[model samples]
Target: MRDLRIGIIGVGVMGADHAERVVRRISGARLVAVSDPDLPRATTLAESLGSSSAPAAGTGDGDAIRVIEDPLALIGNAEVDAVIIASPGFAHAEQLMACLEHGKPVLCEKPLTMDTESSLRVVEAEHKLGRQLIQVGFMRRFDPEYAALKQLLDSGELGRTLLLHNVHRNKTVPESFRSEMIVRDSLVHEVDVARWLFDDEIARITVRAPKPTGLVADGVLDPQLAVFEMASGAIADVEVFVNFQVGYEVRCEAVAEKGSATIGLGVDVLTRRAGHWGGAVPDDYRARFGTAYDIEVQRWVDATARGEIDGPTAWDGYAAAAVCTAGVQSLQEGRPVEVEMARRSEVLG
Candidate 1:
C-alpha cells in the first residue's frame, strides 16, 4: 500500500511529537509536509524527516516537503492527502473549515473550537458537506483502560451506568495560562469523557469553587469541582486540581446497576527499606495516554485512507463544546447552567 501523505499544521510540543511518530513509527503514513508560523522551526522539522522543504507550489523533487507560513495554504496543497491539526485551540475552527471546504479529511485536536459559536460553524459546515470529514482528537476513548471499561459497560457487566466519578490532577501549570483555561483546557477532557463514556449529552452543569488551600499558591486555582447531569439521567462528577503536588493522575469509576468497574493506576508498587510501600506515577498525560494517542492517529490514518469517517465525529466535538461552554458559564455565574445541543442527522444515521 502506498503511504498516505500527511501534513502537520503545528510544530509545538504535541505537533512535533506527531510528526516524529509519522516519520519514525507509523507504517502507511508519511510526514510529507509541515507548517508553523515559525518558518525556521518548520524547515528544521521538515529537514529532520529526511525531506527538504518545498516552496509555496510544493514543486520539487518528491523528497522535499513544503514548509509554509500559512495553514490555509498547507490545506490546499495537492500533496497533502490528510491534515493533522495540532495548532492553537483558537485556530482549530478556521483550519478545520478550510479542510472541509477542500473536501480533505482532517484530524483535529479536541474542543473543536475554543468557543461555542465557532464550534457551531464547524458543525454547520460538516452538515453542509453531507459527510463527516473531521475527527476530533479526544484520545481518551482510544485509551486501553477506558476502552476496557467501556467494553465492560457494553457487555452488561456494569449494567446501566448510573454515575461516573473522575479525578484529574496535575502538579502545576504555568502562571501565564489564563485562569479560565483550567476549565477550557484541563477540565474539557472530563467533559468529553463523560459524553463518550455514557454516550449521553450533558443536560446541566454546575461548578463549585471552594477556598484555596495553602498547598495551592495564590495565583493558582488548585481544586475545582464540576457537576454534570447527563441526558440519560446519569450523574457525573469531576474534580480538577492543578496543584496536586504529585505526579499526573487520572481516575474514573463507573457505578452501574449490576456492578462497578474502575480504571487502575498504571503503576507498580515497591517496598522501601524505610518500611513503606510506594508506587511510581506518570509524570504527564503523554505517559499516561501515549498508547491512546498512537491508536488515535493510526485509526485516523486507516479510516481516512479507506475514505471512511471514523473516530470522534464533528457531532462529538459540538457536544463537547456545548458542555464546555456550560462549564464556563457555571464557573462564572456560580450557578447551574443548562447545556443546549443541536441534533445532528449524521450521528443518528
Candidate 2:
C-alpha cells in the first residue's frame, strides 16, 4: 500500500488527535509534517508520533516527521500528498486555496471560513480547478448511528422529514469563549446535520437565548436555541448548552410521517447499580465522537488514496457557514434572518 503523506496544520487538540490517528490507527496515510505558530508544540507532537525531528528527506532512527514553520509551506511540501487544515477559521480560506493551487487533496475542519464570502472563494477555486479536492471534516456523517439515521430517512419508509430536533451540550467553555460561539462553534454541527439529513439548504434562522447558567466563563452565553427553516420545507431546531456541567452530548431526533428516529444517547456503557440505572457521560467532544472521528479519518484517507473526496464537500462547508452566519445575525438582531447562499459554480451545484 503506497502511503499518502499527510501534513496537518495547527497542533491543537484536534490537530494532534488527527496526527496520532494517522500514525497509529489509520491506514493508507502517514503524518509526514506538522506546523504551528508555536514551534515547540509542533515539535512535541512530531516527537510523540514516533518521529524524530528530521526534514522530509532526513530520516532519523525512526519515521521522522518534518516540522514546517509555515502552513503554506506545508501545503507545498514535496512529501505532502494531502493537507489537513486544523488551523483556526481565519486561516482556513487561504490554506484551502493553497491546497487548490498546489493541487493537493485537503481535509479541512469546519467553518471552512469565518463567513460566507470566504467559503465561497474556496468553492470558486475548486470549481475553477474542475475537480473535487476538498473534503470538509463534518465527522458526524460517518458515525454509525448518524449514518443509520440518514439511511433510514433515505429509505423513505419514514416519509418526508418534517422536523429535526437537535441538542448539543458541553460541560463548560474556555474564558476566551463568547456568546456568538454558541452559534459559530457549537450549533454549526447541527447546521451541517440539517443539510446532510434533509438534503437541502437552510432558508431561515432564528436565535433565542434563555439566560446564562453562569457556570460557564464570564461573558460567555451558557445556552442558546437556533431554529432553522430548510429549503426543502423541513424545519430543524438546535439547543446548544455549553455549561450544563454534566457531560458532552450530541443528539438528534427526526420526526417524519410514519415514525421518528433518534441518535446520540449517552450510552457508552449502560449499567444497573446502587438500585439505579446509569450510563456514562462523555467528558468532552473527543469522548463523545471518538469512533466517528476514527471512521471519518479512515474513510478520508481511503478516498484520498483513490483520488476522490469521500465526505462533506466544499459546498457543504460553504452552506453550513452561510447558515451559521445567518444564525449569528439572528442572535444579534433578535429576529429571523434568511441565509445568504449563492451557488456560483456548477461543480458545487
Candidate 3:
C-alpha cells in the first residue's frame, strides 16, 4: 500500500498520541502536518516528529513535519491525502464540514460535536455530498471483546438480548472534567457501544446522580447510573464513575432469552502471591483500548486508500450525539429524557 500523507488537527493529549501513532506505530500513513490553537504545542509535536515526519508540500524538508497554524488549511493541503480531526468536541462540526467540502476522508474524534444540531449539520452535509467521508473515533467498536459480544448477539446464539449492564470506571479525571461530562465525555462511549451492539437507537435515558464524589475539586457528578431504553425493547444500564481513584475499567454483561455473555474481565497480566491474587488494571484508556484504537486507525487508513469509508459512520456519530444530549438533559431535568433525532436519509441508512 502507498503511504498516505496525513494532517492532524489539535495537539492535545489524544491528538498528539494519534499523530505519533500514525507516524511511528501504524502503517501506510505519515504525519505531514499538524495544527492546534496553541501554536507552541503544535510546533512542539512537529519538532518531536524527530526525522519520522514527512514535510507538507512546498516545505523545504521532505522528512520534516510542517506546522500548519490553521487547521482548515491543513485539510486542503495538496500533500495531505486525508485529515484527522482531534480538536475539541465543539470544533468538530466545522472541521468535519470542511473535510466534506474538500472531498477528503476524515477520522474525527467522537461526540462528532457536543450538540445534536451541529452534528446533524455534518450528517446532512455528508449526505448532500453523496459519499461517506467521515468516520467517527468510537474505538470500542474495534475492541475484540466488544466485537465478540456484538457478533454473538447478531448470530442469534444469544437468542434476543434483553439487558446490558455496563460499567465505566476511571481512576481519576482532570480538573477540566465537569459534571455534564459524565454523559458527554465518559458515558458517551457506552452510548455508542450500546447502539452498535444492539443495532438500535436509544429511545429514552434516565440519569441518577445521588451525590458528589468530592474526590476532586470539581463538583461533577460521579458514580452515577444511566439507564438506556433501546428502540428494540432492550435495556442497557451504565454505571459511570470517573473518580474511582482505583483503576480504569469497563465491563458489560448481556442477558439474552437463551443465554448470556460478558466481557471486560481485566484482560491483563495477572499476579499470584502468598496472600493476594489479582491482575493489573489499566490506568487509562490508552492502556486498555490501545490495540483497538490501532486496529481502527489501520483499517481506516487501508480502506480510505482503497477509496472506501470504514467503521462508524456520520449517522452513528449523529445518533450518539443525540443520545448524549438527552443524557445530559436527563441529568438536569431529574427525569427520563427522550432522545430526539431527525429522519435518517436513505443514503445514511
Report, for every candidate in turn, its global Cα lDDT versus the true structure: 0.82, 0.86, 0.87
**TM-scores of the models, in the order given:** 0.91, 0.94, 0.94
Taking all chains together, the TM-score of candidate 1 against the true structure is: 0.91
lDDT of 1 at 282: 74
Task: Order the numbered candidates by lDDT, best leading.
Answer: 3, 2, 1
Residue-pair clashes per candidate: 0, 0, 0
Residue ranges of candidate 3 with Cα displaced over 4 Å? 53-62, 346-349
State the lDDT of candidate 3 residue by residue for 1-349, as single tens digits: 6588889999898998888788767777777899999998888778767454344422223467889888889998888889988898888888898899999999999879989998888888988887789999999999988998898899997688899999999998888888788799899999998998889899999998987786866567777899999998889999999999889999999999998898999846688898998888889999889989889989999899988888999889989989989988899889999999987855366
lDDT of 1: 0.82
Which residue pairs show backbone clashes in model 1? none
Ranking by TM-score: 2, 3, 1
> What residue pairs clash in candidate 3, if any at all?
none
In candidate 2, the residue pairs with backbone N, CA or C atoms under 3 Å apart (3 or more residues apart, or in different chains) clash, namely: none
Q: Which segments of model 2 are wrong by more than 4 Å?
A: 51-61, 344-349
Deviation (Å) of 111 in candidate 1: 1.7
